[model samples]
Target: MRSTGMRARSVPHDSRPVHARPRETEYRPRHPLDLARVVLPQRHGAGDPTMAAANGVIWRASRTPDGPATLALRAGAGGHVRAAAWGPGAEWALDQLPALCGADDDPTGFDAGAHPLVAEAHRRHPDLRIGRTDLVFDALVSAIIEQKVTGMQAFGAWRRIVAWYGERAPGPTPKPMFAPPTIEGWRRVPSWAWHRAGLEPPQSRTIVEAARRGDAIVRAAASAPDADGRERIFTSLRGVGVWTSAETRIRAFGDPDAVSVGDYHLAHHVGFVLTGSRVDDDGMLELLAPWAGQRQRVIRLLYASGIQEPRRGPRMHPEDHRDR
Candidate 1:
């Protein structure tokens, strides 16, 4: 592995204090891999406490199964991904590098040639791949915060919560960052803090509830036989609908077929791109049915194609509920 001389300070969260040190690893993918595309999507926003992409390097902080970790990944010569990690979970994070960088994703049956638009997108970004973090609870918490809110609203709340409750990420990062809160940490966040973070009752309540059942949810998500089975497990919980479940699955498992069926703009965006008309959820599903097993890939391609729905109205105004 190429050396960057990066080091980390381990934060003691377990009974035994982790020796403060840095761990490094490298991975070479067989196919082309767009480091930015695979990693940037995992970040909730530019200000996300747990993720950042800058200067051709991607930094991420997370609560892994083993413990908390901070990871930095950069693309090196010949499609190699160089990863350096810090904190107690550094080894675990290093072990997860391949999956996080899309090693497990296979786009074999996708027929980009079937659609001109898709073909164009595929040509433009042949290296694009869906990446799985395998951090189901983290994805679940972020998805819940995003429910019925604008991206800005959700991102702001996520950043605040992380800053307030999360631990400092152990690394020589460019910016001060924090690992996302542990399951117990999330559950312990006071209701007032959620209010201050701009999280409304429904979203906050759902997150706390989910955190309460975090272990079971994680197990079900990881052990599900198929995407549908996983969806069923997620939707069985309160406040987790198809949209939320799909979003979580997309990040947690790199599931190609999980479409955000009830998204505010996704259906219309798909319709405009595919047929130059606005479409409802049913219509979008119909249009995307041709690519049944790779529906999400189709959406990704459409998004990457730069074909957007024409604006006919002003954007939705953001709401502030801190005083309500």
Candidate 2:
């Protein structure tokens, strides 16, 4: 049977001084860090059960290699990120905090001078970095949920699924959050549950199939030598395509070159920003060819430049599959 919502009560806070010592840590990155940019983009919706950001702090929940964990990150003085964790996977989450906050990202060799617009954007937000999450499965599942659907529909479905199946995050976060389901948990979700969440057969089936081989997928991504190699592993999965693979790599691996070539609005956005006219995917690629290894960075700069293509036609309507 499909669960309508989670019934679990919030875990009580521990009072023991030493054993219940707050599981907290901190990291100071060499590069300037923007807490909101690194974490907020990963949120699927305003009500995303896996994440919450408020009062300059970001809280996240995940099923890590060790177990379920909840993490809170706040920006502190002198480019430092203060973090706290709870649950069995607390240590693992803390250990991975540097990468999650983009400590490993190197913007060297990226010449913002290649384009006037890009240069202006880089001048405005030089601290921009592509953050990475070591949890590839989480990114993959979220990307799959957004496939060929309006943002409203996709976010609604994602929130429903997580609220129904995900476990409550530990610690006293401002808002209640849930850890995303583990791979085995995703495999166990029935078709009826997916339907209730407004997910169609194609996306739900793809997520289940991907979960079945989740371990192998994670290993392949970890072992791959380069962005291209990692992307190949992701695209090999059934129903996974170039756009989905790029989206996953951007979040999971932080591949700066991974452009969403097939995205409906990206090409137009790129074209309008660079050439003052709209272009198709092919044209966008041609214009961006000079920056072969940093295409995604270029797109990011274009977005930061505050240039947008004029809206035309009606917005895509959210589709509800439960009534069908």
Candidate 3:
């Protein structure tokens, strides 16, 4: 049943927050690009409260190192992306715009030559590039929430937690949205709140523990020499593992080689797409070994190919323990 309550007054698109004028930038990509494909992957789920897409504009709310910031991005002619940001961290977010839109992804050695599907997919979408948010703790927290759970369960928990604990975003967002809580805020999420959000005890504990040393973790990951260093940093946490590390890498650093080794469907998807049969994580690794540096890119290309392994059984219905 729809509510008959009065709706809040509408806000104009990207209207300046009362605090200050939006900091703006226009990015020109050297290669072909598709804004949605590059940016929307940053979203945890279709209903992610931190992000929204409407009228060809993508709006995002995030907690930057400086503070919470709202970013609005839209694609324009000639592979140009116009961005506007608001809040104290607006300048920081604007400075990160290029990397956020896949500027840091180097596809130089990715050989799509091995497989026809890979070749065709690469040819079809030359603009395909991995995007990164550069927010390590936030990405780690989201990845931890997703640990060992179905997408339905993880996304639902993420939505609830962020909407409840996060700060309301600045700027004229099309819909109400909020930024993820600060590092200290994550440490402060009560156990009752985690229970209400449908996050398991293990995941919540991991987030809190990680938050205790959040700055050190972020600094270590950022200063690490490569993906291996990041893996060490992430997996050192009691609750984090390879899957969570890979996911965090993909989101925060855009490590092209990072693969979620233990993902429920990833191995199957990769094997099915490349070998016409499902494979285990070991098999998937072997299959992807030929393109070690760009394995994740290959996986993304396979995804862009829109080919899926046919289902052999009924869908797994996730259990919701949340009280109504």
Candidate 4:
């Protein structure tokens, strides 16, 4: 738990070994909600050891100030979200369920009518809202792993590393899931282990560097006055740039205005969706300028539209750089 500052005691990446009665709670959203739009973005990959979705239930393992927590969230009838959590951080997890499911996202004054396509998308996905995990350190680590790589590579690296080093999630989850290691655990990961996990040295080093000041970093970002403040704090770290900062903001705090500026596919997709032609980052930003405060929300609506630039050639294959 956070102390006078944001300092936390030493602990494992997640829950303690002993099992106990899981904490439970229920949240009824003020607006429409769905696991796909909210919790799904937190998954590193389809087979992420940190998350599992089955039988209308979403299971997630996370690290909190108190400790490791495994949360099982199910959307029940009548817009209710029934949740059960296990581990020391269970209460913390339970308390943040509404934010996790987008209850805290305020889209007031956002004009979907700015563009015809955005309006249509907003109409179709009226329940769409940005979700936040509220775990800054965890978000930073994951964002570091994703830098300058194919999604397949990033996802595979995350899956392998978390499964190998992360703590086993508490409770009877649909599938065995793990939470990413504590800040110390992250530093302790051997160099060879990162190579084996398919993460580049630079990315691994960035994570280590960030973890060195993990608690302080979390405090700074969480307490930031606005998206700009978060960006400044995140970019101040070595090897972290706009893309990583934006991704962290989206996952950790659900900043609707944060856009991953250097993302390879984002500019292309945004340009195509808005102008029927792909554009560079500058062009994409220009098209998105109208919705300055809700750029990410507009992007989400674009994604929801299911339009993409056609692929005319073979998909790029993930490169394996491990010692054979």
Task: Quantify all predictions' global Cα lDDT against the true fold.
Answer: 0.86, 0.82, 0.87, 0.86
Tens digits of per-residue lDDT, candidate 3, 96-199, equal 98899899999997789998999999999999989899999999999999987788889999988887778778888887788888888889888877887888
List model 1 lDDT by residue over 68-97, tens digit each.
Answer: 799989999988999999988999999988
Show the colliding residue pairs in model 4.
1-65, 14-68, 15-68
- Runs in model 2 deviating more than 4 A are 1-21, 318-324
Clash statistics: count for each candidate = 0, 0, 0, 3
Clashing pairs in 2: none
Candidate 2 residue-wise lDDT, 71-123, digit = tens? 88999999799998988889999998888887777788898888898899988
Residue 321 of model 3, lDDT score: 24
TM-score of 3: 0.92
Candidate order, TM-score descending: 3, 4, 1, 2
Determine which window of 10 residues in candidate 2 has minimal summed lDDT.
Answer: 9-18
How high is each candidate's TM-score?
Answer: 0.91, 0.90, 0.92, 0.91
lDDT of 4 by residue, 292-314 (tens): 99999999999999998898689
RMSD of 4: 6.9
Runs with alpha carbons beyond 4 Å of true place in candidate 3: 1-20, 317-324
- Model 3 / residue 324 / CA error / Å: 30
